[model samples]
Target: MIPGYPKETFFVPDGIYLLSHSVGCLPVSTEKHLSDSFFRPWANSGGHAWTNWLDNINAFTQALAQLFNSNAQNFCPQVNLSSALTKILFSLPTPTHRNKVVFSARDFPSIGTVLQKYCKTLELEPVMIPQDRNLADPQTWSDFLDEEVSIALITHVVSNTGQKLPIRDIVQLCRDRTITSIVDIAQSAGIIPVDLSHWQADFVIGSCVKWLCGGPGAGYLWVSDNNIHECQPDDIGWFSHKDPMSLTMNNFEYAPDARRFTGGTPSVIPFTLATESIKLMHSAGIEHIHSHNKKLLSRLASQLNVNSPCQPNERGGTFVVSFSNNQKALQTLTSAGVHCDLRSEGLRLSPHLYNSASDIDTLAELINPLLGKRR
Candidate 1:
């Protein structure tokens, strides 16, 4: 872990917090950023506040780029993953033959909800990947993509089961097949390394609230340098216009970079919060966070009498512990001051760098009653 890091950066409580996978603990610096970067500028500059407020957007992208290990120019800020995915889905050229957007049942429900609406559009279809199948191999999705597939949305790490998909191979396969790849790194952004160049991903979507510690409303989308020129998003507004100030509605030329994916007026508050979180994470380093979590997770996993769904190495920073009644188990832990979350899979326990081994032990010990077996 980054030495003397989380102790200074995080504002976590004394109790065990095993829900970083769901929503991260807020940074102590959040209020400062929100005030200085957002409200102070707005109150002082009045109507002219767009100057540094816009600069905060740039800074936010830069922070995310540092976190994602990609170009700041390629990252476009959004409100949520659903909106980001909406842009990508609507931006696609209406196909004459190819019609499928392939994803699994285990994929984030919002994605399925978005695609379900678009599937009815001309030349757009939805192809379901069986979540019941083994995900141990990263190349598992390669077999699902064929000529009929127009786009592929892969969840790098599943939200419920904490299954890390084989996105590198899947993206490569999409490239080989002339298909578009949109990888969702919502659960993986802070906990796992998502190098766009390494994966050769066409597009990547993530959020700042979880893992990044940025809080809610900062949704992020990264468009690959190679794919920008080919995409002309239909979901754009004044911001996406090449010369937004030109004010010629009839003449529509997009900003030549990832800003091409941007639309309408932007949200300044979330990015202000996100900027500090991303910067803090960059200072701490993704690898360090991953390493620390792995060690902490091992401690938690060892104490669980119930079977953990994922092996320590296979998942991201979290794992699922099943129970006869997962909700009751979750309530049992919560009432005792152990704050974890429940999902379709089971009780989700995610330990970040902020969580100590003692915290993990406390969670494990407190969860004994839910295991349906005596400790």
Candidate 2:
């Protein structure tokens, strides 16, 4: 725990606790926020809820917008990024003749799975760009750009490889070919800078539970204004209406914003907790937090590069780091109290802003010998 912050009053001390990208640890502030919301839900519910909800939500969205250098109006609260993605993907207007969606093999399964099911139902194609060693080469992506590509979904940072994709360039590529670009920012959200407005991306899906330090079940979706008119979600609920409880029968008006993506009553407790977590991140300053995270990743990589299976050039830039398949080494480190995770072929260390240099040193001390033994 850093000085002055004093651990924010709540955190579990067991385990190495360096998996913010996977699931962030809730700060004490969030604990308080949820507790307060629980004890006074009626006081915090309805128009009063919307009033306070919108206030906190707007603040949360504004902070995220600033992080992405986007307009606050373009940001809307949702259950999570996956729900948002489903809303947008399912709501797209039927394309003329070409109905295929294109994305990379490296993208998270959720993106592809949703598109695949949607395409099957629509009698369209799902074109997945092939990967070379789990890396989606830009040329392959460009080559897939054609009349058949109605939507091009990609991730800003791969959850598995931690590789950061050139989302801006991909956006431009999609626009030139008239393919809608959807980017999943879950793994990259707070740890890196993303200017969705500047990038001109059509849709951005992300979660608050990752680098943002929010607890589980909290996420957000950013939709470009132009794309809103193209979406007519079939799963629209009463909350999606412009005036959900207007007491008028047979009158439905969808919100002229991204709020249309959110469904029925949300998990308010998690949302409240998430809001507090964002406030904490904002108070710390996102840029400072990002810098701190980068420094930690840099140090971790430096320590692991010694006789490691993967080369420096192959490393990804986020909090997660991947090494070529080394389960034995991973098990060795895990058993040593240096908490790290592995996926398929790599060991990932996703440290948050709260972690310190001493943490990195501790992790290195345990893993170095393990790698040496492997050699």
Candidate 3:
């Protein structure tokens, strides 16, 4: 059992919850925290509540800062990852000599969709590294960062396969080539250790819905100090102004930091809820959580027909167990009160701090018969 992480801390369901990769279980403190931080102030003071609500937003950034080991000023609260990417894509100046945008086909579908939709309008060439190639190899990424590549979108962890990319190496490669690197930490943020300052990527984006135990709509964007000055975000509003309170007519100046990416009136509730979860994770300690997850993954790997990378360092928290016919097994697991997800690759099972060894054993018992002999 992992110390300092009691299962009672979160709202565990009647059955096992192995879907932390999709959406994390809600923390027990979420409701009370939201009521105290958000609802009460709005009900009591109305417009005057902006002061407290804004403070909550700052608190949210502070929580992320603590998690990522970066300054709170670097983060801009976004509605979701796709929206954040859209703003960044629109903000960057159209490349003159460099026109290629590089990404992997194994990346989340939404990222590819966003890139495809904007590449034509931005006059950029979309170069996708096919799935057949070994994505884990740094050489594969290095080969793609040619002279014409202006931006490279690197996924810290492949969502479907649970393959952890060598982000530090990839980011450094992009830096050396003068390519703007955007690291997507949606799958790695809460489960793996992420240091924004250490990455030194041009931009980083993620959401709190998964693994964070923070509900949806709480996505974020972090810009490196070296790159913030160069961004000119087209998606701007009153909040994007250096002084949002200064009601000067027709004179709009971008905020000197990452806040320039925050468009219009910011959504307060999501950040408020996310702040509680982020702080909770910070208090529990990322290293401890990571260690616990690895132990559980090892147990699962030994018992299941695992398809993800064998080394703990080479994969994220989730494990993908391959099966010839997954539909029947999926139904049986679902009926037996065992929760996990099925993807094109295989059955994806992601355990969290709340889960126990027995849960893993139970999962294996239910699915082992269906999997037949272990290869």
Candidate 4:
């Protein structure tokens, strides 16, 4: 029953945009915000624009802090999630005894790839939970976090399957075992209510391009205050210095907070664009948007054979449903102006605040006949 969502605030595609799980619809104010915050400063001040541009990045972190219910000082902007993970993996001291780095097979392939490639050099064994194992079960993770496990990468939500994990419980399990936990919130951040304080994970990483409606290159990392000092990022630069303006080439000290993860000159324009979209999401309230999305998903679920978790709380904003002929169904849905994407698991249909019940009805009507039809 949440109302007053300003759908006009975003520039939705001509067809139904159920692809927010991939790339979010652009915010209508993105251009103006970019112009005012980024382009104008560069145009007006040229070399002197660093002050405003840096302020825009700070504003981006501030908006993220508010959204996730945590301190702004705990966040450091990165180019993307993969880079953030790389920084974290390289920063942590190689374990003396615990040599295993654990992740789920269901996790986004990029994460597994990063772990596989890096663990070899780091002398850590990359252990993946088998694809058949239930990732949503806390026991499944507890069994995997043996004494040999030093680090665990927990995806807050499975991208392809729309399965939401019990991150808090899993993080607690890791904490009990003295295993460092890195929670990936890329799929869950904008749509789900994320309270970093509650999870208290050692580290959390995500990108703004997906559901945040922020353009690419605005990824961020959040390190716990308890664990921040212990991290010594191998990827340090002037930006990671205690004082970025110190100009002391010989005496470089890491910034005492999460800024230690920042490397070199930060990308300013992406943060500028992200700050605007984040502010827009804040204006609408995440809880309200979550409620609206669930309602639409529920309506759609009633008509479709959803492959995602049956319970609303067990899934993210996106829902996965199977089709007899994946290509044909995708083509039919596209032809009918119902935009969505096919993952290896199934077709993913994501509904945002801009989508309505009628949109779901349209999707159902078109998809019902294509459910089990032969090609």
- The stretch of ten residues in a row with the least summed lDDT in candidate 4 is 304-313
lDDT of 3 by residue, 101-197 (tens): 9998999999988987779887789999998877778999989999999999999989888989889999999989999999999998888999987
Candidate 2: which stretches are off by over 4 Å?
Answer: 1-12, 41-59, 133-137, 247-249, 306-325
- Any residue pairs clashing in model 2, and if so which? none
lDDT of 4 at 253: 94
TM-score of each: 0.95, 0.88, 0.97, 0.97
Cα lDDT tens digits, model 1, 80-151, are 999998888778667767888888898899998887777876547788888776665645676788899888
Please rank every candidate by TM-score, starting with the best: 3, 4, 1, 2
lDDT of 4: 0.89
lDDT tens digits, residues 1-375, model 4?
236556787899887889999889899989998999899989999989999999998999999999998999999999888889988988988798998999999888888899888899877799999988888889999899999999999999899889889999999999999999999999987888899999999999998898889989999999999989989999999999999899486999999999999879988989999999888888788888888889898888788754464357788889887776888888989998888999987889999878878888988888778875744
- So what's the TM-score on candidate 4? 0.97
Ranked candidates (lDDT, high to low): 3, 4, 1, 2
Whole-model lDDT values for every prediction:
0.83, 0.71, 0.89, 0.89
The reply for model 3, stretches above 4 Å from the true place, is 309-311, 373-375
Which pairs clash (backbone N, Cα, C closer than 3 Å) in model 4?
none
Candidate 3 global TM-score: 0.97
